[model samples]
Target: MPHPASAAPTSRFPAWLLICGSLMAIAPLSIDMYLPSFPTLAGDLGVDIGQVQLTLGAFLVGLALGQAFYGPFSDRFGRKPPLYVGLCLYVLAAMGCALARNVESLMLWRFLQALGGCAGMVMARAVIRDRLEAHESARAFSSLMLVMGVAPILAPIIGGAVLTVSGWRAIFWVLSGAGLLILLLVHLRMEESLDRRHAAPLRLGTVARSYAELLRDREFLGYSLSAGFGSAGMFAYISGSPFVLIELHGIAPSHYGFVFGANALGLITMSQLNARLVRGRSLDQVLGATLLAALAAGMVLAVAALAGMAVLPVLLGGFFVFIGALGCVSPNASALALAHQGHRAGTASALMGTLQFSLGTLGGAAVSVWRDGSALPLGVVMAACGAGAVLMRHYGRSGARARPGAR
Candidate 1:
């Protein structure tokens, strides 16, 4: 089992973990880079809070749709074509976002930009699988998570600083620069990982049938949904947390990045910690523990909010715990879902990416619906997603226990 980022055919641990990790970081970089600028964009563009929120939703829609194209195309062609194409598109899209004069324009460009970004995000996972084994994929995922962790931690801090000097538009410029760096890095370090020796000539009919088979696989569906809904909880928080923290609680807009980054700290720290636990226990065994912990954290937030105990520390600690638990839970769940789908890994990865981002959009929508200028609304959304994931994992594991396993 070779690490996908590893260039050598027989090498399991790629020497360029830093490089592969950075390529994977592009999507998160596109996202967290602008979070600190959300409020500023609303004011500069003369848009309502809801309209500004569409920027986030648009990125997600693009990300969802972008994967459908990149996945099969990558499967048919090779990895680098999509990577190069997507990075170029991301730069163009980021520039468009920088130039947007109105909410509608920003939303459209943001979605279109995600169309490029979704390629980087989805292919990173496929590449890791292309290079590694079940447990090794989890390890590579941890590396990827660590890289993603830096974007959330550093992007907003950079955004906040840039805002003081140049305003929100500067953030897009920075994203464009980041995308350019990724483009160069991929050329220098990444080699093609996919072997199309047995790959079917990728066609519309075959691709449709491939997707159909994936949709009907109960075990794959179970694990994918379990990881996906769990991730939706975090996206709900991402969509609404800034509003709750800055506007409602009176935390300064400049400080929102730190609060957001604090949650990433929780997620990053736990994900790396979970990596250490993988050798001693199976991924499922570890997820059973972590998802329950997240469920408990969400429940506490819900109960505490009901008791009029909705305070800053409670909000911070609860999210820190829930998202941290998700860091451990999600990568493992995704790894498990694709574990046995070795032949159609590209198609399988696409559907999981599709479902994951789809849930993310729906979760963002849920936040908008209950968005009543308070932490309680967001807390309830998180609680429901966390509880839903727990239920899915519970029954999904049992259902598989009684059946023949994946080929």
Candidate 2:
């Protein structure tokens, strides 16, 4: 195995793949690992499900705000120190989460936890940019997704077992330990990908200007939104699936993890294959294929739902294919969008990820509101987001033409 550090920068990759994967996995690990524990939390904290769910929104808000700072700080200072500080904070906040006596306290701690976690999550992409060229970045990102993908596949099972054996608090103990381990790996072995070439005193003003520029630029927004909405499509499925399956189709809550893992498997499978698909095609061409495929798959699901095809296997199987296309669409579209934002990659990545997650949270919320023990609402939501992705792509090319500098 090539070392993630000290690997020669050839077109061929070395072991930095592990670093990329580990970094990207941080948030998914945090989220997925805690999901199965939500019920326990609600019961223990003497709160309703909605109260417990707010913890998710709290964490998401912190992630967005913290990402805004992390990218600029990393650009200004260096990659390693910010992460070290952030991870330390993460451990503390996670411990706080474990100890909280009420819903309000848990929400506050979860927010802090996300703030700290965003350091690793955002910078992972920046570090990837630091080490690789554009095409290489896309490939490396896909490889990283492969690493992060394991969280959804395994977190629930582990959380379930922990819940059965110990209690919800045990979940935080696991997280705290994981954070400590990551902290060690990073300090002992992870080298600073932020090089001397970065402009001195990477000022907040400069970062602000970068965000300003990205906002004014339509191509960046369009491509970014395509990826963002594609993510929202998956979120729609996630929020609606449990109800649609459990209440409507009678799947057990205990088996929800397996159902969830099946979808993630589709995502992982597609992401792993993305590099091969793009080998000879232009990035846009590959992205177009993925988007069209998503649109097509979603149309199938919509039809199935409208036609009273209420079978659980078919509903999930269709979404399995749909989310798989999304896995391909999201990374490739994001890679293409950020291709030229070298000086402001952190800001760009933060903006993209923030909007992606925000849209995700919104889509999930929509499912909860519109839910009625049927698959139609979820199918409609997925189809709507899929269509939005297509429109975003349509606008992205035009925007690219208008803004000559958008890379």
Candidate 3:
């Protein structure tokens, strides 16, 4: 195992950390970059806006399912092998997306793209767990949020520029190139982090039983659900924002990237702050506080929408607050969820990703199905997710307190 001191808070940020963050960034890059082109994509494909949104949902589904397999594969073989396979597949699928002719084909390619890209997400978490304890892992995750946050801030701007210059097809070409570049980086720089002696078997029944046991773990469930619902709220924003800003509020597609970047900036700032906050307080304490703040933001958003006050400033403010809270919530919740699962870190990480993306898929689908040319549905769904996260956190704390020798 690598020295734990290498991940120490005072140590300089490392190259391997950057590689892990880049790996985990595939999702945000794939999701956010195409957002600015939604209207154009709909027009070019000769489909309605909703059909274009289906591609996003399909990608989320792929992320949810793909992580499950990647986790075990990483554990059974080694981290680098699954990453090599996944990135290769990602490059090919991205090329497929670039060449897609219709909405149906686009959705199919996006799903395949996600299947290939999510290996990074699963393995990055497992790798971090393999190298650090709970507290250090939280700090590392916060650092990762800093890195991943840049994707949302830049992807749309890059996408909008590509859309303006070449066309929507060019966006997928950019993604393909990115996947290829990352694949090369992984091959050259990423050392295998999994200790071979501790590798879990890739047996079907064993994997199922492992996942079932994790589900039965109250602390794990709490952190997972809290993180999942918090993420679901963000996915709700991602699904709803393009229409709410560009179509309803008359923000030009070309200029939409700036508005999206502002929200992402907020998220990034809060995540960095969370890194400091955890130094003074426990992860649970910080997570609980942030979850409450998220709940408040969501309720405010819902109230504003219901009051027919879905103006630009109101919506943006609500989204900034709600999404920003996730920066703190995610790192803390993820660290807590996998804190005790070092023996099966890959499986734990995969299950957590699966739940998070599954909830996110539902959140995106809800926004699509409940699209009434208004922001009410988005507000309600986000608010509901926020409430659920808070409740789950409370339940988890209660359960922890009830146990005789709980962590």
Clashes of each: 2, 0, 0
Q: Write the per-residue lDDT of candidate 1 for residues 229-341, one digit (tens) a residue.
A: 88788888888887878887888877888888888888899889888999899888898899898888888888887788989889888989998998888788888878777
For model 2, the local distance difference test gives 0.76
lDDT of each: 0.80, 0.76, 0.91
Candidate 3 local lDDT, 1-407, one digit each (tens): 43342356355367778888999899999999999999999999999999999999999999999999988888889788999989999999999999999999999999999999999999999988888888889999999989989999999999999999999999999999999999999999888888888879999999999999998888888889889999899999999999999999999998999988988899899989998999989999999999999999999889999999988898989999998999999999999989888888899999999999999999999998898889999999999999999998887676566656765
Candidate with top lDDT is 3
Q: What would the TM-score be for candidate 3 when compared with the true structure? A: 0.97
Instruction: Assess candidate 3 and give its lDDT.
Output: 0.91
By summed lDDT, the worst window of 10 consecutive residues in model 1 runs over 1-10
Q: Which candidate gets the maximum TM-score versus the true structure?
A: 3
Model 2: lDDT of residue 221: 84
Once fitted onto the true fold, the runs of candidate 3 whose alpha carbons sit more than 4 angstroms away are: 1-10, 402-404
- The candidate, 2 or 3, that scores higher on lDDT is 3
| Segments in model 2 whose C-alpha atoms lie over 4 Å from true places | 1-13, 200-204, 300-308, 402-407
**Model 1: residue 322 alpha-carbon error in angstroms:** 0.7
